[model samples]
Target chain A: MQINLPSLDGTENITAVCMRPDRYTRLYEALTCDTPVIARGGGLSYCNAGAGRGCRTVVSTCFDRILAFDAEKRLLTVEPGMRLGDLFEFAVRHGLYFPVLPGHPSITVGGCAGFNVHGKTQHNVGHFIDYVERFTLFHPDHGEITCSRTDHESLFRLTIGGFGLTGYITNITLRLIPLKGRSVLFQKRFVANLKEAVEVMKQLSEKVDVLYSWNNLNKTGDAFGEGIVFSEQFIDEETSARDKPFHLFTPDMRSVLRFNFYYRPSAHMECAVYYNMERLTGVEKRCALKATAFPIHGKEIYYLLFGKQGLREYQMLIPHDEWAGALDDLRALMNRMKMPLTLGSMKFFTGAQDLLNYRGDGICLVLDVPANRNSVEYFNKLDEIVIAHKGVVNLSKDSRLTAGTVATMFPEYERFKNELNEFDPKKRFNSALRMRIDV
Target chain B: MSDKKTAVVIGASSGVGRAMARELAYRGYRLVLVARDRAELDILAGDLRIRAKVEAVVSPLDLAAATTSGIQEFVARCAADHPAIERVAITAGQVSDDDQGPTPLPLLESIVKTNYLAVIELVAGFARHMEQHAGGTIAVCSSIAAATPRGRNTVYSSAKAGLETYCRGLQHHYRDTPVRIQAFALGYVDTAMSFGQKLLFPAASAEDTARYMADKMSTDFRVGFYPRFWRPIVMVLAHLPWGVYKRMKF
Candidate 1:
């Protein structure tokens, strides 16, 4: 069967077969087939963690359920098919929460677990595996194996953020945040340029709970990093103390259309950001925590804004020492390629703990470039810049990277393959992204 | 942990019960979270501990099992562990098993046991515990389904109706005592139960519904509507003539 999955960046996901697995037994059975296999979650990953395309792809959405929940212990044992929205709803309702979750609610537990995703508060809270107590895996030959800190420790680290290369993760036991309040205290400060932004981040790194910034992409000449710095703190209060508790999200087509039609970071978009940044400078706002969880607008709208062709998201982590120099190389590459970036976001990472982790004592910069003729080569060059800087490309977000390039970047890539090969030596497990990167 | 004021939140795992528990926790109340899923309950407790910086204990019980005395045992456990209990919020609800044709009697019985009988047992046990403390508050969640019983969700509606009736008696019983009981009549709420479906008019978010219920429960009102908009809607529907109401679709 012909299955097409278009990423948020407009690249079509063309695959020969797609298998929806309801149980771990079924997933194991599917893995035994002759063709290469990969698992697809909620499909929120712009990066190719699913590894679809000409492979026997098993969609994991049907595997959804809350197998066990220990709210006090803050442990969630769930199937990979569960969506972040459901988990967030369940967690917040219980006065608990999940950390380092990507903004889009459609992102699945399996996807986050596989990629070990992080969000705005990552610098403070850490990655997906930070909360993961353990995971239940289905090996092609070994059957079900439980991996955690106490048991199968290396396998546990390998499996987490391993991009499903190790085996199929059927269930995950995660530690969660037991938050008292349903909201966060947010503040936005404007910076003059990248220099000021880095300085401010250094000062606030240990002080604030939430920290990240949006770049002034619309600016020309020297003001590339000049934009808004958004910082937030989780308020400690009873959820009941608020005057208004329920702030529902309703999708409006008008905003979607506007973004789709005229939402590029062009002069008009730049002007909007400029005024918004000017007005929001030094202003602190408090809102229900969910308000901050997703973007102030919504992911759906931002998604729709990409239009039919879609946009490519290239995220890379550059060391703190080379951060400014790397940005110079990046801007030059974008200029040389003539592919102007639509959006850019920067966040601080303390370091990575997972086997194939992106976190490091560095600055992670994510760029949104409209998918076009120049885009692929531009991304490839971006990978080169990261490798040169002794930084790592966010494999979970990069579709253009190759195994050769990733090997040079992530020193642990060879070991990750060795660990994976030990379980499925024939290399039956794969995804389009993993294969593209030659992983 | 024990030094803080304690609140025993029933249905602390999801829906309005989950919301109400979260709201109360923000008010600086130590919590004993009760639900069938101990894992989820503990997750909530963990959240309260981290976010509110308060102690939240988990007490998971099968609300439907009768002979095993799920409610009695759970309350006994609460009294033993959290003796300073001041509030009890029941936000648990149930629906018909929609899997096969013609819902079975056992499933209907389970629905009633969870939605009605288990609730009464919890109130009776907690009411006694609250009798020792002054200004103890007990809040229960009813539904719009109770006002007009329809054929589709007959068991669920009847269970809610029975619960509301019991609350009336509970109010009378606790009239002289400081233990006050509040009933929340809520309309359509956007929750996991209502996931991937379109709901009727006058719907609100779970966070909003939870916050509203938590705040009002602290007041003197015996009964309240979740969004407050639902009160008029339910009132107009209750007064509608059967002939006209029967012709209309829910």
Candidate 2:
């Protein structure tokens, strides 16, 4: 009853400093506190990087402001709170663009840097961390430190995909690339079989700057294992003049329903029905469907259809040569087990400097599974297949990846551990996943 | 509506509970926030503590466990810590529509215990403490679906209806006393719990509903229907004969 309420859960108690500081000195003083600290952005990372665990305090830098932008240098120096979407919009206004952005719009620049997030065009450009000119971070031990390739190279390298284990990222200067044009040529092609899909993706990767695939593993027949490969290429100035700028549009009800149903269906069937009928059908039909599916959505759908009891995501990087075989194995495994995978697909990344970058020279298969007990065997089987190919997994997206698999996947495991230990020697920012991965 | 009043809200991590938490915080009420998800509760509590400058205590607990006795102990402790805890809000019920055969009586009983019984217990424990001093407020979250029974959510609606009726009786019993009993007859709100579901009626935002309910708490109102206007409309509709009400689609 008379307990002290920590601001957020996970690693640190962030209740004390959730407001904007008037001066840099004040902010620095807060960061230098004896309690272990981690900077948080949009609070979207699945793991405990933002919240950590058992840490005395956390400094949320989501309120950081954009101090300056040098259009001529194609560089922008901003506080951590500026969101990736907002940054991208700013770049677009100046006829330049931030080449890398994750799928979610609400993610912050600090988070992207902390995770070194890769986008669809990662195969062509590489991780977002590579574009940074330099960044100023406030560390509890080192005080204020500025890092870049030319400056604090080790700190810089460790910060990317570091999960904020290094220190608080205060301000970062990101290098922007000139956009050929605002128009992006978009195309979606359906692949028939695993081999065909792999071949088509390989061919498309050569011709396209951005490529990703979505496979509905549950559908049978000709469409069974069939997936849509989306390709995009930046247009030239002449093409841009003729074509319209790419405008972001919110998907309509039907599309939204289809996306939610096929992508990440909730545990509840009534929820699924409500989503489908309300968006896909007329008002009268929606009412009728509600009558039949009143309490259709609940924990059972999540527990039975999805996987176990918690949230589950497994993402692994397969080299270009092994992509076909991986896809084949994946298809066979899904079919043999009759497991319903909401999403199964391959993503192409250019490459990343981080030794542990999961996006290397090939396609990455990302599977989003519900954390249900029944789905454990399927996940274990899938993990075995991914490991056999010497593929690496992204810890940021994984909730169910076993420790053995993680140790084998991330090549720079020891090095990352060393860096994390140096920053948080007490291991204060530990979580279930962090403890499992020994990070 | 007491000056510098305090309230404790369970399931305040998101959805209706979160809305109510924000509403009470904005009105300058100290809060004790509880939920299973620590990350969400922390972020919410942090925002409220700073933006509203109200004291907040975040405690994450699994409500469906035997350890929940500790929650009552915690509530009693909070009441002792903050004498201003003049209001208690129970908004921690869930809706599950799984095909695990017919809704079992045990499941229904669990809903009743969580939505109704636990509330009564908490009220009794807190009310006894508050009775020694001045009277306080107890608001229970009951669904509007309780008004009309439907197919899927038979057990859920039944439990909510029971809770609403219980609150009505409690209000009558507490008449002329300083203590107030209120029931929030909530319709669908845009929340993560109801993310994929569509509402048959026009849904009110949790923020708006919370503000409406909190504002009404200071007044003589005992039952607050979200969106204000829906009150008269639903009251008339609930009074309609089953022959006509059942024939018409919600």
For A191-266, candidate 2 gives per-residue lDDT tens digits of 7754566678878778876677766566555565566666766654332133221222111111222122222233
Model 2, position A271: C-alpha lDDT score: 34
- Please list the C-alpha lDDT of all candidates, in the order they appear: 0.73, 0.63
Task: List where candidate 2 sits over 4 angstroms from the true fold.
Answer: A1-30, A56-61, A220-224, A236-311, A352-354, A427-433, B1-250
lDDT tens digits by residue: candidate 1, B29-55: 888888777766765676566545677
Instruction: State the displacement of the C-alpha of residue A175, model 1, in Å, after optimal TM-score superposition.
Output: 13
How does chain A of every candidate compare to the true chain A by TM-score?
Answer: 0.88, 0.76
- Backbone clash tally (model 1): 39
Best by DockQ: 1
lDDT of candidate 1 over A164-252, digit per residue (tens): 87778888888888675677788887787766787888888898888888876545467756777778888865344344322223222
Task: At residue A155, give the lDDT of candidate 1.
Answer: 88
- Note the B-chain TM-score for every model: 0.92, 0.86
